[model samples]
Target: MGENINFNIVLFEPEIPQNTGNIGRTCVLTNCKLHLIKPLGFSLDEKQVRRAGLDYWKDVDVEIHESFEELRKKYKDGVFYFCTTKGKKYHTDVKYNRGDFLVFGKESAGLPDEVRNSDPDRCIRVPMINTTDRSLNLSNTVAIIAYEALRQVEFPNMK
Candidate 1:
């Protein structure tokens, strides 16, 4: 991705270390920033995390926040798009821009009501088949939304 273009991938209370590591690698590949909220399920030093990232974890731009409010305070001017199954629009519907914040919630429960309600118009979701599956995997969800945003921007700086 272009050095001038940047996006933020916010994970609120991610439960799995492997997923977080995988997402971290994705961020590194896409030139996006990774924001991890507090109360993560696994320690950052866990072997699973390192194994998933495969020596690239250090290269990933990762930021840890004590809470969502802290993250909001840091990026007060950011345009946040909360990814949830209850989103009113599909992921591709939004016109993504550089520096947009793509927020995802916990694996099992998804984003809390307060968060989803915070900015209802900004909520988005991936179009999934009508099945019993409650939602997609956390890492997969991030990749889908991230790539969609990248695609809309013509894959800037990506060869």
Candidate 2:
């Protein structure tokens, strides 16, 4: 990647502040960019976010986006992977490229059908025991997939 960013983590209307805070810490450590779509459930300000131990929030490369379309327009060539429980492929099945976009949905409702269904081939999921159980926590899910991508890319600038 030309920039310092090794990858992109796009959250489509994330709800919990703690989850976002945790994900932001991961982004800072991984040199990934975090793009938050509008209609976020909690504040990004340090006070509430610190509940998740995001003391280095300012070091995170975060961008507030008005819409997914706007983000696509900005990063026109970015390869996007939609992560959903409804995905057709396991996350590890796909090869991750540096600077690719890993798109996740909100805590309650996942990516709107339109977005997830838009590209079936690009949709992915983490292996789970049962579909009935509540899916993994948002931050955990992000960490699992993000680290897998980092591993595929040899952890980029991370030691």
Candidate 3:
């Protein structure tokens, strides 16, 4: 059998329940694990999450981390790729593989300086219009990058 592709979608202090829920649904659809850091603006168990994700919540594999350090301790071998508009490298340029973790920050502030600068070598960004000053919606951005990573890993015979 082909090796299982262990993909993880990490949200650092996510701020919106709907966006998180949508990301959760995407994780379920793509067979990727979802990891969320604490201090979320909206409750993960909120009705918004349930409403947005609908029945997809049951299929999604989700892990809640109290802190990045907590998660880092558990997943050492995985590549941590932080997504940011300020990143010098494009997401497409990364040679994504199994056990790669794609991390996104909060909607309002993006990744904190310490976190964004934690591993500059692993930061990735999506190309966007120069005329526009803002990034894509959190859910949309996550779906785009996660699917690309999934595609690169051969989508791994997902069920």
Candidate 4:
């Protein structure tokens, strides 16, 4: 009945194939785009991904970008919000809508300095429990944020 609200999940040099696969599944279920920035730690067809994502890959709409710069140029006007453990703003507070690009950093180092500092004000994070050394899994975190965004837009039933 109305235009579907689309969100983009950008993975910056993702290290874990399974995590990427899980994120892909989330995108498929939520009706969003998943962007992978190379060079990835493993091939997209790696065993871990196939196992984790099951048979969802066929239906997943995934875009592979050569670099972060490519995504920046393509989505210059869209809001790019980097999700990091060190982000100043909480992910829940950000008003997500259609056309928002939510970017996540690598598994090992999180986001690089250039990316983390590029748009300090837009980066966001999910608040973690106290006394924890690490944050939520990359794919898990994306699911949380992406679903919230989809929910905000009212999850319209598109035929």
Candidate 5:
């Protein structure tokens, strides 16, 4: 696919059904594609997921990948941005473009050390007052960065 969707939201080994479901809903409302990596914590057909996504869950443009490497190999030329707590820069510091991939991590562990450190410059994070405390919810984190990207591009195809 050549620049089919405005943006891509990739959840790597997401562990929470409700978080994934809420992220799916966000993707639908923002006109972004949702990609779920392998080893999902909950089944897509789970009731909790549908309940969280509400009626719009069926309308979400979602793709399931066996692995992150599979997705990367498929989209070799795609631009990818990693979301991690280890990032030195804020999500707003980057300039997003159409077809860019925003890769998010799982709820508990987050992106692996290798992935997060692979491209330090490409990694970004949301600002928080307390670093030692709990991180933001996975859904909230995705929404924040996705909206920022959408905002940068003036929210194309969205009202």
Candidate 6:
């Protein structure tokens, strides 16, 4: 993994432990930072989370924040792109850069209107087939957007 991590994946009020664990593993493999905003639905020590992350949990650079506001305050100058179903543009439409923050909302409800609307131009979403009423799984959604951004930057520090 790279010593200088360039991307961050932020989960706001994530509900599922398994999903978070999976995302954490992805972060570890990609050398990206994982920022989790409370309140999480499951304990960080949950067995399911460990199982989902397999043996990669400890390698993940995970940061826990009390709330979205706290995270925002910490990364005051960060370039954040909120991912939501209501976003006007597709995730692929954006030209991702290093040090960009990719934010995903809770499993049940996506990002709040206030957050999504804060910078409408920075909001993005994965396209879905109209036949389904459900959105993509949280872990899958994170992987999709993360990889796209990583791809845009030519998968830095990856063999």
lDDT by candidate, in order shown: 0.91, 0.88, 0.86, 0.85, 0.90, 0.91
TM-score of each candidate structure, all chains considered together: 0.95, 0.94, 0.93, 0.91, 0.96, 0.95
Off by over 4 Å in 3: 1-5, 131-133
- Extract clashing residue pairs from model 6: none
The candidate maximizing TM-score is 5
lDDT of 2 at 110: 87
Q: Distance from true position, residue 91, model 3, in Å?
A: 0.5
RMSD (Cα, Å) of candidate 3?
2.3
Write candidate 6's Cα lDDT for 1-159 as tens digits. Answer: 224886899999989999999999999999899999988899999998889999999898999999888888988888899999888899999998888899999999888888788899999999998744689999999999999999999999897
Error of 3 at 133 (Å): 4.1
Tell how far residue 155 is off in model 4, in angstroms.
1.9
Q: Candidate 1's residue-wise lDDT over 120-149, tens digit each?
A: 999999999776657789999999999999
Clashing residue pair totals per candidate (backbone < 3 A)? 0, 0, 0, 0, 0, 0
lDDT of 4: 0.85
Q: How well does model 6 score by local distance difference test? A: 0.91
- What lDDT score is found at residue 88 in candidate 4? 89
Error of 6 at 84 (Å): 0.5
